[model samples]
Target: MKRLLCLAVAAASIPVSAEDRTLEHVLVSVPIHRQESNSVLPVTVITSEELQRSVATTIGETLENRAGLANSSFGPGVGRPVIRGQQGPRAITLQNNTSSADVSSFSPDHAVTVEPLLAKSIEVLRGPSTLLYGGGAIGGIVNVIDNRIPRERIEGIEGAAEYRYDYAPDLNSGVGVLEAGFGNLAFHLSGTSRSTSDLRIPGRAIDEAALAEQEEMMGHDEEHEGEDHEGEEHGEEEINNSKGKIANTDTDTDVITAGFSFHFDEKGSYAGFAVNNLNNKYGIPPGAHEHGHEEEHGEHEGEEHEGEDHEEEEHEGEEHEGEDHEGEEEEEEIVRIDMDQTRYDAMVHLYEPMDSIEVVRGFLTYTDYEHKELEGSEVGTRFKRDTWETRLEVVHNALLGTEGVVGLQAKSDTFEAVGEEGFIPKTDSTELGLFLIEDFHRNEWTYEAGLRGEYVERDPSTNAASNEDFTNWSASLSALWQFDDNWQTGVSLARSARAPSTEELFSNVDAMDPEELVTHAATGIIEVGDPDLDNETSLNADLALQWHSANSWAELSVFYNQFNDYIFLRNSGEEVDETAVYDYLQEDAKFYGVEFESSFHLTDLGPGALALDLRGDAIRGDFKDNGDVPRLPPVRVGARLSWTGDAFGTWVSVLNAGDQDRPGDFETDTDGYTRLDLGADYRFSFAQERELLVFIKWKNITDEEIRLSTSFLRNYAPEAGQSVAAGIRFSF
Candidate 1:
């Protein structure tokens, strides 16, 4: 396979850009693996330079602008990527094709382990080829590619370090990395740290009266009992203030990775092993409070009550009563939430080409992740999981005038929740699957088809009482046609399925009360009947077109996805009459949308080249009377203008969100607003091998009080207002 790829490379006569030359000539290059012939799949590639140029804090935030992607944020510190509107366990996150081993499925507060700053490139595989991954990848796959281990035998060492700071939004961040190679051995390591204070709006903060009006228009009362009462009082006073500061919104992260590879020159193959450990300590947003109501009566009340009691028990010194009162006040329960997480992952990869036929590749990985949350009165749920995966594939050549590929994979996972009482029962899951892919191409037309057969088993350890086993199949077909060097069109149809995770099955604990009115409920209070949950299946179809001309690029896509037995947590109005009570249930759902994006370069400018980019998405979907999947984002459109030159680059973008009427049983409609972001960078050469990038960014330029549909705190806490940030990056 390596020789074939080499031959193809040598035979090609395409002009290579300077960036491409640097990657292929200076850095070790690996064969660009192509999906088997006749398979209809689409993969989007994001270069490292793109990541560097984006003013994003997390991997999910960086990709949110991409087509067909969305992000759910837990304040500014955490975010999860959503592909085609599907998230959680259904979307697999990979670091070099291995699971990230994080608790992303359990909640939105947890951060992914992959460091966006350290990544070399990001690959998003859509369509059928996702079956090559585990069954969890029903949505798609996000692979964070990095050069931690040597891809080829080398003889020396190389490393780079960077530091960045942004002042407008009050942010400071830095990273350090090192890599070394000796003969066939290599290693890489990196660390990053960041901190930010309250983010300010771009202009004058929204007037308190305006906020009240907006809330009222959205069917939300400004003075609901135990709901934003303080804001209401402040509004009554005619005081205009900035949005609440993002408390504990700082972050400290560290990562260490190392690997060793052995080059087999005779066999034209390389075998390697790698391990990564990530530790992060970040702030969780503050929960909303009901007015200025103190949890306690007051010091005067306690003293007065103590005095009365002392009079009654004059013989029993008052000192004892005073001490008791103080203790009681100090011990009053006040919810203070915080989170800590750690992940460890190890993987092994082997590549070898057979003397005849095709090349064979094998991969095995083991991952362990632990997450813990601390909150007053809450059960403080903790989850730990261990997963093992192995895959073997055989790439076939066109011996019979047809090219194709076949693969087999098996995965086992153990998920356990300790200290959750009886709410979340420990679970063990195992899955096995076999897949085949065939790719065929003739002139300007390409076609592909693939299918996968899978078996899954789930068991509850606490009570040998509940267990389940099921078999499922997934398939997809796609076709792409190129009309010219600058135009291409494609269509795809696929069937996908997702099994339930432990959290969806038995999570029975009070996670947290973001809104003060909602008290905690027993985990899985709604209950799970029969333990025999069927798989959620979906049929999806999409049509896409791409046009790339000399200085311009554009893409448009339309898609529809229908699901059978879509699993959702429904607001069971009964809820023991409990506020914010929701039950897990299954129902049918359908989602359809169209997205368009385009970019045009205005080269006839002054000192720098100018470009305009526009993108938008409109989606409408419904779930069986479940009140329109709560937290589904609203239709949004955005446009950006950028200028790049030898020493300076800058970009400004405006985003607008449409109103959302979809509501959960206990949910309310959300108003929409517009925001603006502007950023600029200046480059300077410091030395022969060092450079610097000084940048500044302003977000929410209009100071619009925008509310994101994907936010859990939308009821009481609004999204952050506009703010400015400036930073410098020094590289060596």
Candidate 2:
């Protein structure tokens, strides 16, 4: 590792292109066909070139500690992105501009379904994007774009494959993506498989919060220790907590997809369809999720030899367990997540400029998704969602003296969850929305405006107040001024509203059920819902300033959001099912934050140019009467010293997060920590215009014990310890 570090920083004379560090990357997720550096809203585009070098098993881990992003992680297996301090129903996750339709938004323990290995790029839109997407994007949207539908025809055959291995978790992953075309027909295929063993941690995962809850779990440990005399208490044994490792956090993931498209070849008219499926099985953090028989499973390793003698009989018994009421009672059920999704999408595009319309597009998608919480062979809970969505948009060259697009969208989703531990009630949801957007440039001023009206209805099988209907309107207005030759400024104002989710309205039934059953897996507290919760309304104002050039760019944004009826889940200082009770409540709330991104190129170095990239964000969340809102991300700052070389490139960064002392009611304070991360990649041309890329990334190099203020399971499972990941990719 040390020698590799030397090779990374040591300058080798390889001419590097300065344009590689420019901000001219075209962003496909931009509402308007504008470059990222000129977009009105804050958009961060992680290009395929960038993502390939920093890909991870989970999105949260992949983006953790970024400017305004954090991972609400439940061990290594489960991590959901928390954007600008908002998660769950507030942030909308998307794939190719459509909802991911996964359970990750339903619970913090759930994992995001999309695979990064197949993505061409990942776009993150900051702040409210309700007019373009929907009310669900009040927080923001993350769109993962891939060639699932073969938007463009390939000349012949082109593909990419990658193999990766990580040291910390003993992980191995293989990925392959192929694109081929014959005449006007194009086909795309991609697949990835990944598996990992238990993750090693810096310590026993014993933080202050864990220490407080350890008393209740002492008995389980004692019982297992009594089963055998391993001399763990011997004089030669190490006593430091670092000797212990995080348990039950292993994961295995697989994804496969196929797509085909037929194009006009002459005109820009094309139609395509794609099918994709994902299967993932991963363990929950040890203490956070447990099956009653902790001692039995804990000592299984010691008893494995004895169990092998009876393995044949045990296998036979499992087959006939239906006949025996209490079959194989000794088999310990491991708490894990088993999920799969099969999705189909079809899209049509016509670019033959009509008299008034410049382009016309239609999109339709159907998804069948299901996930389960498994305890041994029995499923503790099962969740199923079936959705059909359709959208049509018309882009006109000139409309009302401005260039703009009008769109109509409709969707129907049926969600059902059943099992002993299903917390939220089943519901059927439908939505209809009509939106219009216009943007025009006049002299030194650029103006944009949008309006959207949506109708939403939620019906629950149970007659609970969770049933609801609403017709809401959202609008946004923004204006940008060319302050100078290379400087621009803009301001935007919006009125947005969001209806309650089934979980927020009907979850009154669940107390984080498993959190109570498994003391360690607790999601901080038990949460109940108020069916009478009203829609949340927010008025937002944002100001942005930017300076852009060929080799440098910088942007700073400040925003303030005021809410009349802010719905939230708050700890009520009570107990339900042996866990602290949290109830869905509403009150006046306010949020203010600042986000900044900038990159500057210095003088040319040996064979490359040196650049300093910097970013940071801070926010404060509060209620009118209540002291503070819960689970807000910490104030953070980070910087990267980058060197762009022709064949060899590297960047080293240090990220610092301030301590979170102003926790919400019933919340605990978290200590702050600093982390160092390093990345190095070398590209070699094996053939003309074709390259093989080899990269190495080292994360948490100092092996800091990080407890997230935004995650409920932080105390139980800190982030992964020091890890070294290396991978090679072949691309044409």
Candidate 3:
């Protein structure tokens, strides 16, 4: 702890120049846009400039290295945010304050449909946003802001385009975007495409079974089909994967968005509408296929038969008998995730500074999402989700000596699944909520509080499933005291409640054998659900410190959370249908974590400015059984030396993670490794009011073999190895 304080003190020594001032980040997830320094919640904002500097494949990976954040990486196409050691339904992803409305939270293998390539800004709000968002946000919220909803009218026309590529995975990507306006009307259009081959790793950390599972699903027996497993050592055959390639981990994606807006004569008033369509198809790093995995588990309930789909579709009369032709034949039957989503959003802003209110805002969105798990060209587990949401807020600049916002939010969604591997049952979920938030200040001191009440219902298609009508309430209070011009400290307390998700209440997959366990297609763990589960209520506390100026800044945040009736999966210590049996259960749990971030301007070396950046985060969680939480990220610390000039920028950083020894039940320890990254960028203006920026970055420069504690596939697939990425982008 003393060492952490010393680091903060050192970071506080940076000097600030008035010429290149850093804009303090701000938060807009709330009804009103406010500076981070004024918000009670711990917020991390990543500007568009920062996004352009990093080579990120998924939205979750883009912010995974940030303080108090982790990524649940499933191959290269899937990355869900894990904040403060909480994930899944506990945390939520949003697109401009609306839920992403994807099935990413349903399982780790499912990818999020939102594209980060065209994002204008991103925000991570730590702690509960139960009032503003919903019970789905017991952990936090990640909001990606895009230009789909035009906010201003251009004089003529303007646009930007970017093309990017990487060597390690042979990735190619590009994006085109434009905006035009006539009088009070404006329009926006954008398109993005990305494709990549199999991912590359440093070593063969992958297991042999993972590589051979695809062929096994294709109805080929190694001993009889001539692909003999001759030198099996202790049941672990190293499949020559040392070639440094993680097969079936490739991806292809395309996205298009259009929007229009009409501005009124009154300032701060506008109405806009947008539509976005996303299509993505990505491989699921071989191995998790089971029984040809049909989409409907109930089709053959209580049956011991698995993988009968190959009964007639054996190679489709393709080539056979030859060794080379057979090898290509088996590799062709890899599994992939095919997904698409379309969303429409309409929003309005009105400015009428009356005696009681300052402004009124409304936003509505509709989303249709679907994804199919393909096992050798046949749909395995098909999932679909449709959602509609709307919110209205009234903001008051001063109400009884306090600034306040009152809002009402409603949402409804239907989720359905079919196919052999379908785990969760069909269900309809709806919510209605009301919230009131206020902020008060007095001479360098600030106090904020919020209250929320919500009603949620979960109805399943099966009459045997549980139906719930839950009423939940949440409250939070915070006090910030600025002791000096450059130093400030604050504490926040919150009590939030989250209702059970659909999967936790109605998942009842028909295992291959009623007496044995069956592995889940997504998690590779057999799972069951309980219809009697209850809502989880949490008491959270946070303490934070900040000291900042124009060129230097330091921050430290610590948090603790305790929950009652926490819904979690528990191993039954038994086998069903030849797979491990895990059932949903309720228990008491506790989670705690600390995060530190600091930046110091070292010295102005020649014509450029030099700075030192240091950051670290760690967390631990346990249930009443004293068992560690599953897939928790390990402790990490890193530092970077950066330089900035008139038209050039460069940075070098080293990130290190500690070994994770506190493994969950039935889990093994994960070794740690260090990674180095170097990046540089240059900007050139070829025309008036137009500039092109080019950048190159080398990630994992040492080519270290690494596994993340937060990944479900840590044992079967390691993180990407050393890769060189370069890109060019232009704007006018």
Candidate 4:
């Protein structure tokens, strides 16, 4: 790791020309209600500029680097953001305050349908927001804000177009965006396409040792070559040195979106609609060689064994042939395992104020989503979901102002899995919640407090007996103190909970191969309809300090969280026939973390100014006897130093992650490593009304082989190494 840091420093010293400086920062702004009177939750906001500068391909990837957040990748095409180590249905994803209807909650193989390129801003809300959103948000919420509809009537026509390209490891990608506005109406449209072949490690070939171990598990011998036929001759070189393309390793994705909105004359009144479509295809890596042998033996054993007397002889021959056939089949299957996914979403939102009361406001949202996946010869699975939400709130202006809000929400989902034995089911749920908040501000001291109550009822389509109902509540309090003009401190405490989703309670399907096993349950250990499967509750606390001086700023925060009856996946200790069963269980757990960030101007030697920024996140967690959770991101630290001026800007950074020792009952230990990246941009002002910007970036500077602990492909191969990309943007 020290050597890796040294390499990164050396790479950062690369020369940059004076004419190459440019502003590459992304600028974002969104309308938000004042938090003074209604909400005490600590919400973090990330601008588009911050996301654009990071070497991230997806929205989840961009958020994973944030403090107290973890991201797990199923492969190159799928990633889910984990808040304080909680993921899946526990964390909610919202596009413009509406739920994203993608099948990402059901499986890791599916990709999120929302596009990051079109987002104006992304907000992560922490604390007790579950009352308004539902049981799925015990952890937190990720909100993607986009402006596809006009909030007011436009007097003239206006439009903007943007294009970007990136190159990394063995992958290359491009994106295009277009937006226009006319007469009280605005429309947004965008298209993005990307493709990547097999990735390559920086300084190493495919981890042959790891591959050999995987082959052994599959029951294959290392001495065998590619030959499977009896009496077939094999070359010594082929048997001794195995080198070839890795299996199930490719990715391709495309997306398109179109949306429009209009506004009325009344203040705080607007309505808009949007439509999004996405398509993605990726490969699923193959299992070990031994599994292949058993399958081959089973397939040809009946045909090869003709008579009873020869059955014994045929069995012996079958063993040898099966092993060879398995080896060959493993290679073939890895390259052939392909899956495709398609999704569509439509959403509408309206916000207005009552005429009788200037402090009273109302908001409503409705969304419809459909998604489907295709794997091999199977028709895959399909899901359709609909959601509607309404909220009414009144603001206060007096001392220690009082605010109250009441909300109602409903969600319905239908699922279908087509195959030999068709499986079809559906779930519908409705929730009602009420909240009140009070804020007091005097001199340098501020205090906030809020509470919420929610009632929920879930109904199942296929199994009427599975219907369930419950009520839950959450509350929070926070205080901030201003020590001086440049210094401030804050502390917050909250209690929250998460209710089980339909997929966790009543969906049973075969979703894995030999090496990987997945089992859904019709009823969890907590029991459905037991009236006792209430929300899983948690307590959270945070302390933070911020300091700002002329040309510099810094922040540090520490947080702790404890959960009672935490919903987690664990080994059931019992196998059905020959397959392992992992049941969703509730247990106690704890998590703690500290984060620090700072940015400062280093020098003024250029056209503008040179700056340096440092940031890092460290997290640790304990699970009560259930073992550590699978795919927990390891502690990571990174820093970037850049020189920014009028026409040119350059930056270099290094990232390091500690090895992960926490493995679930079915997981393996993952090694840690470091990576380096550098980027620069240049701008040219041709005409007063026209400007051109060019960006060039180099990732994995030293091409170090680093594998993320939270990656599913870590066992087979690490992430891509060094690569370069250059693109040009024009505005007029």
Candidate 5:
């Protein structure tokens, strides 16, 4: 701890003027379009340059360094962001202000479809501003903005291409984009391809401590198996455990997008459409337990020979053939997911549409998405979702010294799952929402208020499940005060409600019969849902202070949320068919957290301008009636030092995660870990106008073992070890 503080202090003495200024002026697009500093909410915007430098295969990995964010990784291919100790359905992911339309929220092993490399800018919004998207966004929102719609007209043709390689995973990735404009019409095309081998780790793939605990328990159980010789001792079994590399962690992905837009009315009103297709094949690391078929086959065989058939089955050739076939199938299968999505989007924006409206915007999107979970050569389960969504907003002119936006959003989707792990039946879901927001400005204060109402309905195809509907509403109010020349403070309060999701209400497991129970292969648990689940609601409060000067900027925020009928999945202390049982239940819960981020610019101590960036975040969550919330992220703190010149830049950063001693029920503790990384880049002009840039990065130089508390696969697969990544880009 002392060494970490010393490094932070030394790094804090440097300065970077250019980057600080750029961050101050960046605009955030969610809720409303406004400058980051001018808004009453907590917002973080990653510009194109910053995004290019830190882009990763998953959105969670790309933004994990930011304050208040953690990556809950399933493997190298799947990472979902956990915000302020909230994840899954609580934190919403968007693409250009629209839903990404993926089933990532349904399970931790599923991957988000958004590609960070293709984004022009990424915006993160927290606090009351999240109400504009959905009341369910109690945690936060992530929106990836791309140029596929072409909001502005370009005069000429421009394009860029880049390639990157990483040594640890033998990853090779490339991206290309091209844009052309002819008068009022513009065309855009882009593509990206990424492929990686199995992830490499520093030591054994499995956590030995966790494995030992399991074996010890098993040994105790085995000791009482034989009453005739209860005093006899047994030897431990010798198992072959893989080392250095995590098997079945490879991934391959490809994306293609084409768009065209036509600008008219003096470039004020433009309509455009874009088409995108994505295909990905990724592996699940061993121990994820994709054995839905194996369990069923074993149970059926056991039931068939329960009585006098035991002796007959032992002598039957057909029974032996059946056993051999099942063995072959098990040996030939490796669990993986093959996913694809085709999306179409259209948008139109109008300025000064009427006397009372300053701007009007409309968006329409249709998506066809499907993913098949493969158990070796055969598909274990196939999940499909077809969705269409539309939204319209009118920015009304100032009235009574207030300005705001009124919006309407509607979405519909049909979701289906087939084959062995299909716990939830086919369901059709529909949602409609109406929202209003108003902003009032004063000499030293800015006040904003918003209200939203929504209707959600789910209808299942099977008669065993009935239709469910909900009416939900939310409200928020916030005020920002500029108390001093370099200091500002904000206070916000909100009440948000979220309706139950399809899976939360419709997971079908026959509790009466163990053999008939449904098990989710990805999680290795029998999950049962309640049909009478109520809406989950929360009351949130936030306070923030920000200070800025010529050479420094800092922000501190604290938030608390109290929930009524919080929805959570919990183990029921029951086992059926040799699998644990989990049920979706509601209980009162509370979460609170603090986050601090600061950057200091100092005089050039060497050949280039220097700056220091420091960030830290901590969160705690627990149920009011009982124990701590499960899988909460540990406290984290980090620091970075960077030096930049006209053509060259270099940076070093260190992040440390505190020990997670408060692991929830049935969870194991995770030790603390510190990671260090360094990178350098150079850019120069060539061919009179074109530019070429080269960069190199060394990640996890210390090669520490990192087991994320928020990850379901933490005990089986640690993060990648020491690796070197290099890339080059050429633009014209």
Candidate 6:
């Protein structure tokens, strides 16, 4: 690694073209097809080149380093993006302008199905996009766009292939894309394969101090250690304490997609369809589900000791009878998940479908998804969801000096979960929404406004709880002013409402006996949902200022939100079967934050050009009566410096996260960390505009023991240690 780094730096003398770091003039599809800089909303777009430089197994991990974002990772297999201080249902994830229709929002351990490596670009829209996507996006929206169903004609055949390997996780990944066009017909194909071994860490997997404190609170001591010894003597297997690496953290995934498009007229009218299939299998960390078992064993320790000798004799007599059975059981005991999904999407676009209508668009999609959690060889739980969604939009001609689009969306879902840990009952849900947005330009100021209304209904399989219905409304307005050539300012305000999700309303535990109450193994807690929950509403405001030049630009934004009837799972300060009890509850809350980003490019720096980028963000959340919110990300600041020549470029970055001290009710404080990384890339241009790019990256160069405050498994699993990753991409 050292030699490679030296060679990359020493190659600066080679004559090459200076790399152009200018922002592309691409339109962000998620926000009404407007350029990010000109829109009233705060948007961040990651182009294809930037995505290739840094892509990970999960979308959250891939975008975690971006300003105002964090990864709520579950071991090395699962990661979901947490925006500002909100996650789950509040922050929506979309693929090509529609919901991915995955169960990631149901639990932190579930993975989002959208693959970042296969995307053409990614758009992150901050603040309320509720008026367009849904009320669920009261926090933000992340849309991954791909050209699987191309709307434009391609000249001929073109493709790209890449292979990457990482040291810490022993990961191997390969991706390929191929596209062809003939006349007015176009076709696309893409696939990716990835696999990994257990993750390497800086030290022990378990935080001994935190574990000891937890055990003490559970009234446990060394006296309970004999329980595990007895189990081992009786031929039962035990999970050993992991050192230097996190056990059961391996993963394997595969994805394939095929699409076709046909253009009907010369005026840019087209129809397209695409199909995608994905399969993944991954393991959960060892300590995630062991806490409840330890607490239960501690509670029974005294009783077991009284009959220790009698039990020993009984066990000795039956040892031979159960040995074979125990061995068979041992083969299947590691906790893992196997999931698959198949999705079909179709869209239609028409130019001048009617008078005063510039365009008419329609989109439809259906998804079939299922997953099973396995304990050893036995299925512990199974989750399945079938979703159908459709949307229609009309882009009308300017009316009264204003341009706008009106849209209608409808969706239906059938979801089921069965097994030991199926806390929420099966349910059917439906939603219908109508929305309209318009923009007006006048002199140096541009103003935009939108409004949306939705109706939602839910029906469960059980009669213990009746069906529920809700009606919600959302609206937003913003103004942008370009008072000078190099300066701009924007202000936005929004009021959004979201109906409660199925899991929040239908997680049933009242029917089960106290001793047999169902528990969510991933979280190791007993959760009870409220059937009478009301819609959550939010009032938000934002202010931003930006300055730009030919090679330099800077932007700063501040935002505040006040929520009514904010929904959260709260610790009830109670226990059942030695497990803590948590209830879905509502409270008024407030969140405020600031984010800033700046980049400067310079010339005449030792045979090459240099660029500097700086970023920082901070947020605070509190309840009107309670203390702080739980699992909020810490304040972070980072900087990167890069040197670019005609053919070779290298960069170095340093990021520091402040300690998280206000870990709301029943949570633990987390220490801060500083991480350093280095990377380099060299391009080789060939004939026919074809090119090959080789890149190398060194992550966590210092091997810091970093624990993310946004993760529930932080105390049991640390992030990966020092590692090197290298890859080569061939584009034609």
Candidate 5: misplaced stretches above 4 Å?
1-20, 23-28, 31-33, 128-130, 214-240, 290-333, 509-512, 605-607, 687-689
RMSD (Cα, Å) for all candidates, in order, is 10.9, 9.2, 6.5, 8.8, 6.7, 7.3
Question: In every candidate, how many clashes are there?
Answer: 23, 6, 18, 15, 6, 5
Q: Which lDDT value does model 3 have at 686?
A: 74
Model 3 misplacement above 4 A: 1-21, 205-242, 290-333, 353-355, 509-520
Better of 5 and 6 by lDDT: 6
Local accuracy of candidate 5 as per-residue lDDT tens digits, 578-648: 56566678888888877777877866766677887888777777887667776677777778888888789
Give the local distance difference test score of model 1. 0.57
**Which candidate model has the greater TM-score, 2 or 3?**
3
Model 1, C-alpha of 527: deviation from truth (Å): 7.3
Clashing pairs for predicted structure model 2, backbone only: 287-520, 287-521, 288-520, 288-521, 333-376, 508-529
> What would the per-residue lDDT of candidate 4 be over residues 121-237, giving only the tens digit for each residue?
677765445645666777778887766554455444443345555554255566555566665566766666777664444543234454444334323343233535333422111
Question: Model 6, 323: alpha-carbon shift in Å?
Answer: 21
Worst 10 residues of 2 by lDDT: 296-305
Specify the highest-lDDT model's number.
6
lDDT of 1 at 554: 69
Candidate 6 local lDDT, 1-732, one digit each (tens)? 121122111111111121322544465344355477778787877778777777888888887877677788888998888887788888889888788999988877778999988998888888878888887788888988898898788879999999999999999999999999999999999999999988989877766575544444434455354475454554443434466788788999999999999998888889999999999998887656544211110011111111222223222332221121144433443678899999999988898877888888888999999999888777878989999999888888878998888999899999887887787788999999999999898999989899999999998988778989999999989999999998999999999999988888887634555665677765556667889999999999999998887777777888999999988776565667556666678889898888877777766588677987777777788888778776777777777888877679899888888788766644457889989999999999999979998999999999999988788777778899999999999999
Candidate 4 Cα errors over 4 Å, as ranges: 1-42, 126-128, 151-157, 169-174, 202-246, 266-268, 287-373, 383-400, 403-408, 416-418, 421-424, 463-465, 509-533, 664-666, 686-689
lDDT of each: 0.57, 0.70, 0.75, 0.53, 0.75, 0.77
Model 6 lDDT, residue 687, Cα? 96
Q: Is candidate 1 or candidate 2 better by lDDT?
A: 2
* Model 3 clash number: 18
Ranked candidates (lDDT, high to low): 6, 5, 3, 2, 1, 4
- Candidate 1: which stretches are off by over 4 Å? 1-42, 126-130, 152-155, 167-169, 197-243, 266-268, 288-352, 355-359, 376-379, 420-422, 509-530, 576-580, 604-608, 625-627, 685-690
lDDT of 2 at 581: 48
Model 5: how far residue 83 lies from native, Å: 1.1
